[model samples]
Target: MKPSNTIKELLDILNSNRIGGVPVVDDKGQLVGMVSDGDVLRYLAPKPLGIAGLVYIIEEQ
Candidate 1:
């Protein structure tokens, strides 16, 4: 996937297929980066409540 992909397109691919992450590639398909579900959350969601969600956040890790 190119860095130019829209958020909607990335989410669509993950949601529709129930995936965790997608490898970002260039014209040659060489791995460049990864877009994970966590990365999406980190974008759409606000920063963790350091104290309140601490347990949940730690558990997630």
Candidate 2:
């Protein structure tokens, strides 16, 4: 699959074919990388908010 493929497209391919993962290739059909459902889920998962700084709330005087 090419990098341009959308998330929905990838999911569709994986689901319709009942595949857990698929290989990504370049224009030459050379292997570039592999992507799995877990990877997709992780990427789509919300990122953590680490090291919260000062957050102040102001009130109407």
Candidates' lDDT values, in order? Answer: 0.78, 0.72
Clashing pairs in 1: none
Error of 1 at 30 (Å): 0.9
Using Cα atoms with residue i matched to residue i, what is each candidate's TM-score against the true structure?
A: 0.70, 0.71
Ten-residue region with minimum lDDT total, candidate 1: 52-61
What does candidate 1's lDDT look like per residue over 1-61, in tens digits? 6888987798789889999899999888888899987786677557766555756654564
Per-residue lDDT tens digits of candidate 2, residues 1-61?
A: 8978987788899989999999999999999999988676656544642333111111110
Candidate 2 lands at a TM-score of 0.71
> In TM-score terms, which candidate is top?
2
